[model samples]
Target: MAIKPAEIKKLASLSRLVVDDKTITDVTDRLSSVLALVDQLQSAQTESIDVSRPFHIAQRLREDEITESNKIDELQATAPEIYNGFFAVPKMID
Candidate 1:
């Protein structure tokens, strides 16, 4: 279905969109095209189609392992301030 300019204006007002006067026709054409495509999609036949079979899969997760990372001294070298082995940042709240 073709949308009217007045209807587009009303929709823009309701949606709080700032649509320029010159671009109204473009917006209307795009909206009409989208509505036509939606209408076409709604009229498609899928009575014998199994839509959920492609998503069926056996998902397995890898086991987690612990690793050693000793970078505290290297990271603390670049801090402006450090207190009790942690980086000291400026307080923001009262």
Candidate 2:
């Protein structure tokens, strides 16, 4: 599908995109390229392809493990104020 500058401008306004007159051509070209790719994909013949079978190989995953670090005293020591093991800050709301 051929993309026009006026259409690009309209879309840009609708999508809150800032597109100047000089940049409209560039944006139109990029949009046209994307539409061309869509056309290519739509024209492909995939009726014989098996949908149940995986198209790509699966990746191996690492095992999840839990680890603990006790640094409460170290963090509390640097705070200006602490209440019940938690840092205390000035009240922000009225």
Candidate 3:
């Protein structure tokens, strides 16, 4: 389907885009071509296609293991205040 200049103008207005008079025709042509391609894709036959198969191969992942040492004591050493293993902050709500 061909996109009209008026439709393009309305779309530009709705999208808050600044489309000038010169570019409106170019934008309309590009949009129309995209819509035509979409229309062509919609006419494709996919009734017999299998949906169970994955499109990509599975990636090899590294083994899950702890790589860093825990430093909670070292980190909390410089805090102004800590309570029950957590940083203490002033209450903001009444």
Candidate 4:
């Protein structure tokens, strides 16, 4: 399906794009080519293709374990203010 210049103008207006007269033909040709490629892709034969199998190989994962000890007190020691184990910031609104 080829895109018309009038449709391109409408799309440009709807998208708030500033497409001049010279570029309208170029834009129409590009959009028409893209639509033609989409049409070609839609006509592909894939009836026997299996959807259950994955295209990529399964990745190996490591066991989840705690590697570091909690250092909340050590980290919060540098904060300017702390309230009930949480950082306190100045109120910005009433």
**Candidate 2 residue lDDT tens string, 5-82:** 999888989999889988888889999999887887778889998877576777778678656588899978988999
Q: Global lDDT of each model?
A: 0.88, 0.87, 0.90, 0.90
Off by over 4 Å in 3: 45-94
lDDT per residue (tens digit) for residues 7-83 in model 3: 89899999999899988888999999999988887787988988775577776798899887999999999999999
Top-scoring candidate (TM-score): 3
Model 1 residue runs over 4 Å out of place are 44-94
Residues 1-94 of candidate 1 have per-residue lDDT tens digits of 8899899999999999978899999999999999888887768788888977667786777668656598898889999999999889889788
User: What number of clashing residue pairs does each candidate have, in the order they appear?
Assistant: 0, 0, 0, 0
| Model 1 lDDT at residue 24 | 94
Candidate 2: residue 61 Cα off by (Å):
28
For all predictions, the C-alpha RMSD in Å is 9.8, 9.2, 10.8, 10.3
- For model 4, give the RMSD to the true fold: 10.3
Assess the local accuracy of residue 89 in candidate 4 as a C-alpha lDDT between 0 and 100. Answer: 94
